[model samples]
Target chain A: MRIKGYVFTLFFVLGVIQDSVDGRPLLLSLSRPHPDSAADFARWLVSQNSWGVLNTIASDLGGAPFGNVVSYSDGLPNKGSGIPYFYLTTLDPTASNALKDQRSSFTISEYPIGTCGKTDPENPTCAKITLTGKLKLLDGNSDEVEYARTALFSKHPEMKDWPKGHNFQIFKLEIEDIFMINWFGGPKPLTVKEYLHIEMNKVAFVV
Target chain B: MRIKGYVFTLFFVLGVIQDSVDGRPLLLSLSRPHPDSAADFARWLVSQNSWGVLNTIASDLGGAPFGNVVSYSDGLPNKGSGIPYFYLTTLDPTASNALKDQRSSFTISEYPIGTCGKTDPENPTCAKITLTGKLKLLDGNSDEVEYARTALFSKHPEMKDWPKGHNFQIFKLEIEDIFMINWFGGPKPLTVKEYLHIEMNKVAFVV
Candidate 1:
């Protein structure tokens, strides 16, 4: 009986490890909101993804649109405030390009979250959102900078240990226009006001 | 003896499945070349990833750079040909935006390939590449279109079934500049010629 108990426990631990590898935690598996709930769905997509492509006008490349992979956060987990915050260093072209031309956009995909299942990343049902706005650097001394840091560090624990000599600083996209495609039919008509004002209650989360 | 054999076979099957999930096929786990081999490294990155952010100038949004999630292919599996090909539809902003302004870039991250392991997506060590140049629509009748279709369908099988009314077409990035950061210092100094011409022998693959 003692030997059998030991074997059972070993299999149980192995099963848990496999589940984590193939499945997201229960909290993350919450069913996606209906596509008609554009505002809520868009915000949920932003809150769940950890990274995206940050685009900027590259003056060096003769004004070509440049996209770079970056990590960002809106708030702590489910408490997203609908604003995407970033940590950038001027050593990269994205920051320099933004300084030269503030016009930019940040895009995230629901495909990475594993909720898209077997759908192609380009499938409208998989969902993709682009937040078009100016990329602005936050004042180092501002209170928002403190909050942004906490939010970023909480999601990406490794950021705090990134090289200080690189001079990484806080940046945020002041979203003016929202473009999202979550389902069939053309882009959904979602106003910036509707997207920003979506109440947290509308976004259901499985306990 | 029969019961013990049945238990052994069950464990063997479970182990095989777990290994398949954790280890990419022997072909993909081929070790990454030294970052110094610029062209080989760039081609490897493009061939290994199935999707990326395709950026285009959104003229309607005050010329802000808009990045959208897209699936792409360089060629058929191990025969990648150094150029990234995409299937796009004008119904989507990325395609329409490209038609209005050819200036664009395609960005891909190594993080999705599962090779980044514990490294943060934004960590310089976790490779990222952006190919900046023109987003040109290919002539539907061209021979390259046939090649592009085969390359794309082989990787993203579901794409072949995407809505036909959407008028999906082939587009390719005419890469003029390569910005890749696979290691700490900064973007590697790689000219388009060097990035396009490196011989395949330089990139080693594990058997």
Candidate 2:
């Protein structure tokens, strides 16, 4: 019995260690809010994910909706403000497109956060959020830029080292609408005000 | 010496086993194509990923670009046709939006595939591709729907069991343009013709 117990503990520890090495969040990190808590669930999905698709109206493509995979931060770790900030370079079409037309959306999925285990990403229950509004570039000297830079660099450290010649600048989604699906029966009705005002204490991270 | 050798072998086996369990691809599975091979690299990105952000012109949202997390498959396993197929329900805005306007883009990233390896997902070297074109709903009785169903089901097994009342239907992206970035440079100039013709023999999966 002692030997069996020892073997079980060893395997458990190994599993946790391997999960960390693979960059997957353990169950403790995935403290999902109940689906009924629409605003909280939307905040949870955005805060947990590090990257998402940033869509823009591409003028070059005859006003087609162009989506690009990009990294973004809502805030630092557990202190997300429900507003997504992005570090974009004009060299990329997304930024350039946004310059031409500020209307855009940022979409993130819970699948990559490891909370929607075994569920297809497209599955209604898997949880996906789209923040729709104007994508505006912030003035470099603004205090919001400082906060956004900190939020972005903390999550994506490599951003600090990106070439200055590329002219990377801070851009944020001025969220006017929120479309989130954490369960069936269509997207939950979540207003931008409701999403932005959700207190952090209401939906605490388990880890 | 014999004890040390045994310990090393045990840990190595455990690591591999844990990686498999975690669903992170073993290093052997990540055979990246040279960044210079635009068509090959683009094809590999689409083939390896089972999900992406499918963007569409949202007529309801003042014609703003809307992106949604979606599961898609090009074909079964290693036999992708370079055209992505999706099983989406009109209950979702993405499918309904596509019906109103065909202009859309499907974007996928290398980050989720576990090959980016410590690189920020937004890092240019990490690779991201957006296939820009029309998102068309295929006829239920079309032969292409059969192929798409097989491809989508093989990748996302849970999709097969989704509620029938939701009315999931087949949709395919008629890729008119290919935008991919695999290295520290601007978008690779990959025409749709070049991307569609890249034979499987040229870029074989390592695993």
Candidate 3:
């Protein structure tokens, strides 16, 4: 009785802390799709995650693959576009690299999503997805840029207050291939067409 | 004092949950190094994080960069070598890609380490690092392999119980260049030699 009250209070406090720390509220409402539902699972992974390693070719380093930590959004909450958009500046190597080569990949892990309970991050049961494609910078005047900005700012409110002198612009990964491993059988057979078209009805509302 | 008792009990329960989910004890002891201490900060980020995205060139996908979620360790707790070691299998594309081309990079984020407080993961204050180097697979008979396996299994206990036929091997990133942004000034200028040679005496105990 009293113990239950304490537990609830604790969780509430922890929830608030997590929300503030992560810059968005905890994803409590959306249920994880079964591993067999590859398209849904892939889309859910992208939409649920706030940040991932965005890989680009570093021409200065003899064209080695360079992965940079960056925040991204597919859309606003449940309204995901299945395409990741970023707010980047030329001051960073990731944006600079993309301008020269454009070949890139973005990787997200289910580990940080707080769902892979007691599972080793490398364990095949833990979900991970990589969207491989050309990283294209969006035009300043495009309607897509407007939609992407809303998506980015809603998730990361501090982004709106960033330094104007940095010349932050929108860049998105034009996914050409998908690589995901959620179960023991190996990489799931998923295509870009399938991933982009899957209806996210099962994801529920974002809390 | 009743409120204090409830808060304590709640935190105790949550700590257990976080430890199990992360597959290691919560890092509540060690203090974060100042961002100006680039070498210490970089080493601390690598040592504390258990998982990251390792990027490689996907030969099958026209040599586009491929990033995969992976588990890694620098050394046994508090005895870090400042070099990232990974347990990889050829079944995964990261290991397969590394074999074809050793040019790769491993990225780690301080966000997962839970010390960034309310900072956004992409914010400069929330440090991130990319170690551009060759991902070399160690020989089976090498003494270094023995050290690496100890480093890996200590942090991730379930690796020992993994399926025997999977044939997981040890791999290390021979870091040549370091790109880290821990504060407002942009990427810190750090070299591989300085990063490896820095004394980790300030990190304190593992608990």
lDDT (CA) for every model shown? 0.81, 0.82, 0.84
lDDT of 2 at B95: 93
Q: Which stretch of 10 consecutive residues in model 3 chain B shows the poorest summed lDDT? A: B12-21
- The per-model DockQ list reads 0.41, 0.48, 0.46
- For model 3, the docking class works out as acceptable
- Lowest summed-lDDT stretch of 10 residues in model 1 chain B? B13-22
lDDT of 3 by residue, B1-207 (tens): 797656543432232112222434545434566677688778878877889999999999888999999999999876689989999989889999999999999999998777676788999999999999999999988999999999999988889888789899999999989999999989999989999997665434434
lDDT of 3 by residue, A1-207 (tens): 698766643432331112222434444434566687788789878987899999999999988999999999998876788999999999999999999999999999988877687688899899999999999999999999999999999988999999999999999999999999999999999999999997654334434
Best by DockQ: 2
Instruction: Report how far residue A66 has shifted in candidate 3, in Å.
Output: 0.2
**lDDT (tens digit, per residue) of candidate 1 on B1-207:** 687666643432231111212223433433455565666678778877788999999999998899999999988775687789999999888899888889999999887666676677899988999999999999999999999999999988988988788899999999999999999889888898987786444334443
Query: lDDT ranking from best to worst?
Result: 3, 2, 1
Model 2 chain B lowest lDDT segment of ten: B12-21
Better of 1 and 2 by TM-score: 2
Q: How well is candidate 2 docked (DockQ)?
A: 0.48
Please give each candidate's TM-score: 0.85, 0.87, 0.88
Which residue pairs come into collision in candidate 1? none
Candidate 3 Cα misplacement greater than 4 A, ranges:
A1-28, A201-203, B1-25, B201-203
